[model samples]
Target: MYVVKSPLPDADLKTVADALQGALVDLVDLALVAKQVHWNVVGPRFRSVHLQLDEVVDSARTHSDTVAERASALGVSPDGRAATVAAGSGISSAPAGWVKDSDAVGALADALGAVITRMRQRIASTAEPDPVSQDIFIAVTADLEKHHWMFQAENA
Candidate 1:
């Protein structure tokens, strides 16, 4: 049964909903990965890397909420369950334990890159169907790209 009605046509809603759901999955996974790395990171740059990881976790969580709310507003349910994220996230798996600071940096950089890439795709796809959602995607991509650049600089 449909509780909320979407403003967009069915076809457009499908595309926008898919994009929002994918974003929620990736953002949730990104926060989890950053937290895991923050806990296990070791080495000379531990302090800096650990702090940076927290920033990523915060951003991911904040943005995930925004994406989910946007989906809800569009009459789509956002799924960010662990199973959904594990199955659909664009991010790769984190190491089991004791990740080196450098590795953690690299991993997060890669994670942000993955999310940003998909977000860009979503932005393009939603431009015509749902410019509002497209705007969210653009903002999210910009934020993730900043973290990605910082992490890459860490390795430089």
Candidate 2:
């Protein structure tokens, strides 16, 4: 059942793999949530909110790829399937139906907050076992935090 071999001991690999998988699921779900809002967002600020949602989607997609690739490189199979994301993601489900501009902003900010919280935990968990993975978590956290700030500002 071992397709690839990881350099780290079983204990370290397990910790790193768990963090990577969690990050992958969250990022995938985050992208899906943002895209859902982008398509359904309505209201006076729709244009700007719509565009902002795309930025979040793009960043999530990019970070998910990086995390997945890192997992693969470390000999762990990354599962980004819809079922996996639905079952394992830390992000809450997006609201169904048309989302108002303000609602969309709030939703994304909240989703990003959830993901960032887990990302911080991952960052800490991976710090000693795998600084490489920790670095990725840090970068991803920075981007998600920036998006959260922008979305919160939209409500201001």
Candidate 3:
């Protein structure tokens, strides 16, 4: 951890930073998995699903950057390397072979939903000790929930 003399205690910052790092790992993995879906999707609605996946990847990347920056600001060095993400992310591995548009939508929705659930927990964890971190997670949760809805709606 680097030097950061914030109002929040060092211990609290460390805890929050750890949580944010975990979030970063998951978001990075999600971004990669979304791109995998984008590349491998096939069906009558292939073009639409393929395009929609780009939006998901964009959102995941945005959140990953935000989360990593927050951790760094708090004096924690976030590990976003592919190995770190693969080892630490909560999201499961996507299928290797080509997938139907509906299947891709379902898989991405499930992955996003899992991360959103975990984000809510992270938000609550920081509610008392670090409200700012909580707010960041709240914002991320809203974005993820919106994406989850879109993916589910597309599948339907």
Candidate 4:
């Protein structure tokens, strides 16, 4: 009756894998939202904001792949379905229709920060501790922080 394969040991690997899956979901959602904003953005700073959104989405997509691959390495099937991701992600849903460039950037930055925080917490909670998880969290956190700063700078 099991739809998804069982996860690895109930140890740090499993914990990191589970957390990676959650991070994957958040990244996928954030990527989609970034692209949505990128395509729909208008106004004076349209070109700049749209380009930035593209960069963010690309980074999110890369992170998603890394996270999913990590999950698979831990003996778990990666849940890449939209419904599953949407249900698992802690990131807020994007509003309908065209949104202001600033609003879109703000929303994406907030989501990225939240995901990075969650990843940090999970990485800290690992019992046996995996270096890969720590490495991934550190890399992702730096990327998210950069994006957050870039978004904030746009407002300045």
Candidate 5:
């Protein structure tokens, strides 16, 4: 942890930072998996799914950066290295090989849904100890829910 002093108590910051670090791991892994699906999706909807996946990737990367930066700002070192994400992320493992368009869409939606669920829990957990951190989680969750809806629409 760094030495910066935040109005939030050190204990509260530590709790919030730990929660954000977990969310960071999920966001990093989500970005990688979204790109993997983007690159490997095949079928009549290939181009459309591919393009949409790019948007998903962009959103995941953006959320990951924000979560990491927030954690850092609170004086904690966020563990967002690829190895850490691979090992610690709560999101499910994506398939190793190419996937069909529908399969990729379903997988991505499911993954995003998982992150949203965990994120909501993290958000609620901060209600008393750190409402600001809860606010960050709420913002990220809203964006992720939108993406999840889009991904689900791809399947419908």
Candidate 6:
């Protein structure tokens, strides 16, 4: 396990680090779910939805890496265990079986939005705040909001 020591207050760093790890876990799970939808989605708008899902999943992966790196920078090992992430993630599990393309898109968007909200809260609460983590959250949130808008547009 690699840890990077920080000069910030121990309690603040520990709390922010834990939150960052938790957010990373959620991001990983959400990324996997988005990819699952991307691969399985089928319908008239398959091409469009498929491409959008791919983009969203890619963004999630990028943000997850950044968040995990931030945690390591703060002297904490980022959580990568599937079970740990599933347990900590606020995103709901996808149902067993193929879902309609629209529903899949909606589900993924909802999960990502929930994560974005949580990340925003955590970023604001960090005491000797990590700017890198905050920036990652900002970027991820914008991507998620775009995903949400796209999915909603598909429904309209």
* Whole-model Cα lDDT of every candidate shown, in order: 0.94, 0.96, 0.88, 0.78, 0.88, 0.78
Off by over 4 Å in 3: 1-6
Q: Write the per-residue lDDT of candidate 3 for residues 7-82, one digit (tens) a residue.
A: 7787887679778988998899999999998999999989988988999899999988898888777767889998
Ranking by lDDT: 2, 1, 3, 5, 6, 4
Residue 3's lDDT within candidate 6 is 52
| Candidate 1: tens digits of C-alpha lDDT, residues 21-117 | 9999999999999999999999999999999999999999999999999999888888988899999999889888899999999999998999999
How do all models score by TM-score? Answer: 0.98, 0.98, 0.95, 0.87, 0.95, 0.89
On lDDT, the stronger of 2 and 5 is: 2
- Please estimate how well model 5 matches the true structure, expressed as its whole-model Cα lDDT: 0.88
Residue pairs in steric clash, candidate 5? none
- Model 4: lDDT of residue 138: 72
Measured by C-alpha RMSD in angstroms, how accurate is candidate 3?
1.2
**lDDT by residue (tens digit), candidate 6, 1-156:** 435687667777767777788788888988888888877888887888888888878888888898888777778888879889878998888655676887887787688778878877876766246666667667767777787788777777
Q: What tens-digit string does per-residue lDDT give for candidate 5 at 25-114?
A: 999989999898888889999999899889988988898888888877777788888898988888888877889999999999999999
lDDT at residue 78 of model 1 (Cα atoms): 88
Off by over 4 Å in 4: 1-9
Misplaced by over 4 Å in model 2 are none
CA lDDT, candidate 4, residue 79: 88
How much does each candidate deviate from the true structure in C-alpha RMSD? 0.6, 0.6, 1.2, 2.9, 1.2, 1.9
Give lDDT tens digits, candidate 4, residues 22-123: 888888988987887787887778899999998889899998898887777666778889899879888877757887877877777777777778877766
